[model samples]
Target: MTRTWTIAGSLSVEPATQRTDLLAEPVAKALAALENHREEAGVAPIDPELADTAAFCEAYGSPLAASANCVVVSGKRAGEVRYAAAMVLATTRADVNNVIKRRLDVRKASFAPMAEAVELTGMEYGGITPVGLPEGWPILVDKAVAEAPELVVGSGIRGSKLLVSGALLASLPGAEVVEDLGKV
Candidate 1:
């Protein structure tokens, strides 16, 4: 299927392969691994100062709905911590207290500490995307995110962003499309 991109604003992007240097190690490797699958990923370098989703969206003119945020949540079971990455539209928040906690079978589910999330994911705090998360971590992709035609996600670093097919994200290994994973 021919892919259509909805990039706006003044951001200039190139094929993901040519921009690996701009991404974190895990993210670069993940991009390489997806090469055989015909993943059409693109990278756009931006000012680190504008790496946050809202800032990036405003600076690049990408619609907020087309921007997806990846958040790391953790819960404890029998003193063991379980981590999961949740992907939701920028316009909504992940249902951590209810849906996620229930799904995880834990009494409580909360966002992981910044240090823990960054260190474990090997990605920057604001750039912790599901693309390169640690093995065995469930990647919960909200239905809306999986259905978007195009999406702008983190590059695993604060210096750039990744533009890819939403379908591609849903197909990532360990990705589970969950309905109502996000809430207004």
Candidate 2:
């Protein structure tokens, strides 16, 4: 199957490697994430009412049960290398102290600023994906997120988003499905 990932102006039609959910690898992966909801094609609601993560899901007519994949700020004073990838329910936050903080062995871990996050991933802060990240970043995904029928991840760059399955995310390049990631 040929998957065509629509970008800002052009389209990406990669050869069939994994299931071609879309022409782009990211879109394909995103489509793959929606395996549980196979009947419903997990396409980004192009005309999103809002830009925030929650707004996207809600606008797409989702049950608001979608998870937001983010690069969390961790370690004392934040901005530390302890940057981790975390996916939490749109309704819940990560448990930092009891989970990621101790797990990363940091004195404190707060959210890294959007500017910093964007800088690190070479992608817009809101569009960071787990598949392609700078080396040595931590991925602390919530176990509950992986169990989700369909989770929303990044599309490499922010121009678009990927709605993939938790199982698919677990099998992604650098994704580490864990329940230890924390939220504030």
Candidate 3:
């Protein structure tokens, strides 16, 4: 079956490989590295003002269920810090306090500061995506997100969004499918 993405909204979808300009540097570099996987991705432009999940969905006509939110979280232990990206559906929240904390094997875990996350990921504050995260950072994907056919996620920039499959996300480097990662 030929795979087609959901872009029924006002956004114009284009092959991510050809629209590298729409992606952040890190995201573009990451996608370029994935020769086979890049073909499975697409990009769409959006107003930066509507980068937020709720606003983007409402303005672009994408449903919350089909959108995935990527959040950066960090934990400290023994003078060391561990950072991970959690990908969950917009309809749910990442179980940061419990599931994520346990998954990272850290005693305490919480959202990473905006400044820190932006500096580290090299992506805009509200446009961080799992595709091009810093090496060594684990990507924890919610089970529901992993099973999704297509999902609207950040393009590492506020001006655009990435269209990708759950399997592609789950196959990203250091990605792990976590059950109950998202709590409704």
Candidate 4:
């Protein structure tokens, strides 16, 4: 399948390949797992220092609206802990206090601690994405995200970013498109 890249000035994106040497282990594994779906996904190398959404968008000339942020949220219910990955546009914030907490059927929901999120997902802080999250964890994609043509997201590490189709992201194994999942 031919992959389309909507890269900004001077940024080059290439098909995501099984390149463990180039990416973090979890990222490489996630890309490999996505092969079965035959979806078009690309990886663009970036300066690790500019991996944060705002910095990355500025450095790469990418629009903040086209960049998605994946946040890990956790809640407890019946003495059991539940985790979920929320994908929202950079312009908005995940409605963790309301939507997510309600969805998880827990009294409260909050962003997972950076160390816990990193350890659980095997991804670096500031670079945890929904694509390679642990099984049984739901991936909640905001309606806007699911409707976008394309988006830039984390690649499980700070050294690169993944460019993917929004529709494809919504179709991931555990993804669910939720209306009003994000709030300004």
Which structure among the candidates has the greatest lDDT? 3
**TM-scores, one per candidate:** 0.94, 0.66, 0.96, 0.93
lDDT, candidate 1, 1-184, per-residue tens: 3334766456787787777898899988887877443358878888999999899888888888889999999999999999999999999999999888987888899999999999999999887788878988889999999998788999899998888877878888788999999999
What is every candidate's alpha-carbon RMSD to the true fold? 1.8, 7.1, 1.6, 1.7
Question: What is the overall TM-score of model 2 with all chains considered together?
Answer: 0.66
Total clashing residue pairs per candidate?
0, 14, 0, 0
lDDT of 3: 0.92
- Lowest summed lDDT across 10 adjacent residues in model 3 is found at 1-10
Compared with the true structure, what per-residue lDDT tens digits does model 4 show for residues 83-132?
A: 99999999999999999999999998999999999999999887788887
Candidate 3's C-alpha runs over 4 A off are 1-3
lDDT of 1 at 154: 91
Q: What is candidate 3's lDDT per residue for 1-184, written digit by digit as tens?
A: 2346664377788889889999999999999898556788989999999999999999989888999999999998887999999999999999999999998889999999999999999999899999999999999999999999889999999999999989989989999999999999
Worst 10 residues of 2 by lDDT: 5-14
Per-candidate local distance difference test: 0.86, 0.55, 0.92, 0.85
Tens-place lDDT per residue, model 2, 1-184, is 4333322112222332232432244444444454343333233424323446666555544445564666555565354456776667666777765677766778877777878776766665566666545556666667777776555555654445555566655655456777645343
TM-score of 4: 0.93
Q: What shift in Å separates residue 19 of candidate 3 from its native position after superposition?
A: 0.4
Instruction: Give the poorly placed runs of model 1, Cα more than 4 Å off.
Output: 1-4, 35-38
Best by TM-score: 3
